[model samples]
Target: MQVKEEKEFTIQKRRCLVVWVYSLKQLKTLKRYGLIHYVSRRMKYVVIYMNEEDIEQSEEKINGLHFVRKVERSYRPDVEMNFAEKIGTKAAYQYKEEEGFEVEEISTQIRLAENV
Candidate 1:
């Protein structure tokens, strides 16, 4: 007997994307998921999204579904850059501190809010 290994939950943001399917026949089945953003029968593709927590699991499941060709990760320049900016938010603070400004924590409270 083989046991399936599970992936650990990763800390991240939820993402939306377009999924490509092998055929229109599979489109109906995959569209059953409400998260599907849209489906293009002419192009033979579907768009869907889910929280980051479920992304890994979903990709596996979706790909395993019959006639699923691929899940396309959509690109959003603004969103990606914003995330990068969030991670680098303290960069300017360090520069200010180096310029003779006293270093201090503006807010000690840890906020997990994605929107700044």
Candidate 2:
């Protein structure tokens, strides 16, 4: 007869966005909490993945720290949203999502906001 033991791991089901902070101390604080696997940096934003329920609490903690910039929830496109549109009127159309002007237009809007 053979006996086997199985180890169970806790699966994280919640998703979140963590803004990247410029302070080493702040990063250390977040790392100390065993939450350092999901960090993404874009421009001045740091996107992190965590439980949705912990977003507000985590943002509050990070904001309370020094040298941290404004914290706001980051938005991601829904996977279910249909995004397979061809960009031009050609017989051999291509699914060039990036070729579309949506993101560029949005970026222009953002730049305009910065000027205001």
Say which candidate scores most in lDDT. Answer: 1
lDDT of 2 by residue, 1-116 (tens): 89888989987655545565665445656653235555544444455566766777777876776766767564552344443454334634656667664434444334566687
Cα TM-score of candidate 1: 0.48
TM-score top scorer? 1
TM-score of predicted model 2? 0.43
Q: Tell me model 2's lDDT, rounded to 2 decimals.
A: 0.58
Q: For residue 77, give model 2's deviation from the true position in Å.
A: 6.5
Pairs of residues clashing in candidate 2 = 16-50, 18-48, 20-46
Q: Model-by-model lDDT, in order?
A: 0.69, 0.58
Residue pairs clashing in model 1 are: none
